[model samples]
Target: MKPATAAKKLGIYLPAAPQDFQDSEVTRAEFNQLQQNPPEWLAELRRNGPHPRPVVAQKLGISISGLARGGVTEPLTTADITTLLAEPPKWLVAERSTHAAVRKQDLIAKKLHSESPKN
Candidate 1:
């Protein structure tokens, strides 16, 4: 797989990865190995991340749009994310509620769909 694909799967920002990792393709076996037992660099990146937008959004329990609305245009480290979670701003609080409501609606829709007759 491409380095970007590998990085996306690993959930780290691609540019933050080492040059070698950015330069090379990752074999399926290597990808699996990395997931099962990450090297120190990968582990450190994951643990103390300048994480990608998707990761930041997931960590914050909000959508990418919510992040944009909150004016978070850049990647954020774990400490940054921790701070946001600990002392959520008004925007973050509002976004979380919106996210929860969307999730609830999604669950209800799925339940209704499942209970309906299938073609």
Candidate 2:
């Protein structure tokens, strides 16, 4: 699979991946192996992403604008994310409701789309 696809499956940011990983294709077996038993590098990347804004926002259960409002201007490691979850600040608590609403809307939209008549 393509590196980006592999990265998504592993829940790691592609840009944060090592040069070798970026330059190579991940075979199906390798993908399975990574899923079954991640290497140190893969584990590290998943835990500490130089993730893009969208990924970070999604992980934090906030919109990009919310992140900006909260003064978050950088990629976060899994540890950082965990810390926030463990001791959620006011901004995060507020954004969690927004995120839940957004997810609910997305589910509603998906259900509607699937129920629509086929072309």
For all candidates in order, the CA lDDT equals 0.98, 0.84
The pairs that clash in candidate 2 are none
Candidate 2 C-alpha lDDT tens digits along 1-119: 99988988777777788899999999999999999999998877766766656777888888988888888887777778888889999999988888789889999999999999999
* Candidate 2: C-alpha lDDT: 0.84
Model 2 error, position 55 (Å): 5.5
True-structure Cα RMSD, model 1: 0.9
Candidate 1, residue 72: the lDDT equals 100
Alpha-carbon RMSD to native, per candidate: 0.9, 3.8
Off by over 4 Å in 2: 50-59, 63-73, 86-90, 102-119
List model 1 lDDT by residue over 3-119, tens digit each: 999999999999999999999999999999999999999999999989999999999999999999999999999999999999999999999999999999999999999999988
Model 1 clash pairs? none
Return the top candidate by lDDT.
1
Question: Candidate 1 overall Cα lDDT vs. reference?
Answer: 0.98
